[model samples]
Target: MEMKTIYFAGGCFWCMVKPFDSFDGIESVKSGYMGGHIENPTYEQVKTGTTDHLEVVEIIYDDAVFSFDKLLEIFFAQIDPTDAGGQYMDRGTQYRTAVFYTDETQKMKTVNYIESIQDRFDKPIVTEIRPAEVFYLAEDEHQDFYKRNPERYKQEQIDRENYIKTQKNLS
Candidate 1:
C-alpha cells in the first residue's frame, strides 16, 4: 500500500483531526501550520495572524485503504464550506477552511469535489482548495492534543462524530 500525505486547514487542528483519525483510510492526522509566509513560524506568530500560515492538520493515509475522493468527502462533512472566515467556535484567517492539494491530480480532484457540492450551500463555498505549501510542525504540546486534553477533546470529538455520522446515515 502506498502512503501519501495531504495537508488541510479546517479550523482548530485539535478538533479537526478527530474525525479524520477515526475514518477507515486515514493512517494518522498531525496538527501543524502551513501555507504561511513566515519561515518556521512560532505558535505566537500564527496566533497573532501576522504570518501567512494557516493552522493545518497533516494527514497520512494509505491509498489502497482509502481513495483521495473519500478523504475529501469526509473532510467536507466536518465543516461548513460556506463559511469563508473560519469554522465554528474558531474565528480568524488562521482558522479558515482549506484543502491543500499536493499536486496537479489532487488539485483537479479537489475542484471536482467542490463542484459536486456547489449547490448544497446557499453561499458559495469559501473553502480554499490550493496547492499545499511548506508545513511547519507545531509545538510539542499541540501534537496529539486530543490525547493530552482528553476531557475537553473527547466531548468535542463525540459531538462532531455524532453529527457527521447522523448526516451520512440520514443521506
Candidate 2:
C-alpha cells in the first residue's frame, strides 16, 4: 500500500480528529501546529495568535484506498471555506482554514476542487493552500481530544454542524 501524508488546518484541532479517524486506510490523524515561524510551539503560544501558527491535523493515509480527492471533499465539508477570519465561533488567525499540500499533485487537486465548487458558494473561498511546513505535534492532552473529552467534543460538533447548516441554506 502506498502511504501519503497531508496537513489540514480546520478551526479547532480538537474537533478535527474524529472525522478522519474512523475511516479505513487512514493510518493516523494527529493534532498539531503548522505554517508558523516558531519551532516547537506550545498550544498556549499558538492559541494566543502571536506565533502565526495554525492548528492543523497531520493525516497519514494509504493512497491506494483513500484518494486525495476524497480527502479534500471530507476536509471541505467540515469547514466554512468563505470565512477568512476564522471558523464558526472561533475567531483568530490560528483558527483559519487552510490546506498544506505536500506536493504538486496535492496542490493541483486542491486548487481544482476549490474551482469546481466555487459556484456553490456566494462568497469567494478564502481557504489558503500553502506548501507543507514543519508540523509540531501538539501536547498529549490535545491529541484524541474527541475521544478523551466526549461531552465537550459533542458540543463543539453541534455548534459546527449548526453553522454548516446555516451556510448551506445561505448558499
Candidate that scores best on TM-score: 2
**lDDT of candidate 1 over 25-73, digit per residue (tens):** 6888898999888799888899887786889999999888888888888
lDDT string for model 2 (1-171, tens) is: 989999999999998898899988999999999988989999999999999999999999999999999999999988889998889878899999999999899999999999999999989999999999999999999999999999999998888788878867996
Scored by lDDT, model 2 comes in at: 0.94
Error of 1 at 80 (Å): 1.1
* TM-score (all chains, Cα) for each model: 0.87, 0.94
Q: With candidate 2 superimposed using the best TM-score fit, by how many Å does residue 155's alpha carbon deviate from the native? A: 1.5
Report lDDT (Cα) of residue 154, candidate 1: 81
Q: Pick the candidate with the highest lDDT.
A: 2
Identify the runs in model 1 with alpha carbons over 4 angstroms from their true place: 155-171
Q: After superposition, how far is residue 72 of candidate 1 from its true place, in Å?
A: 0.7
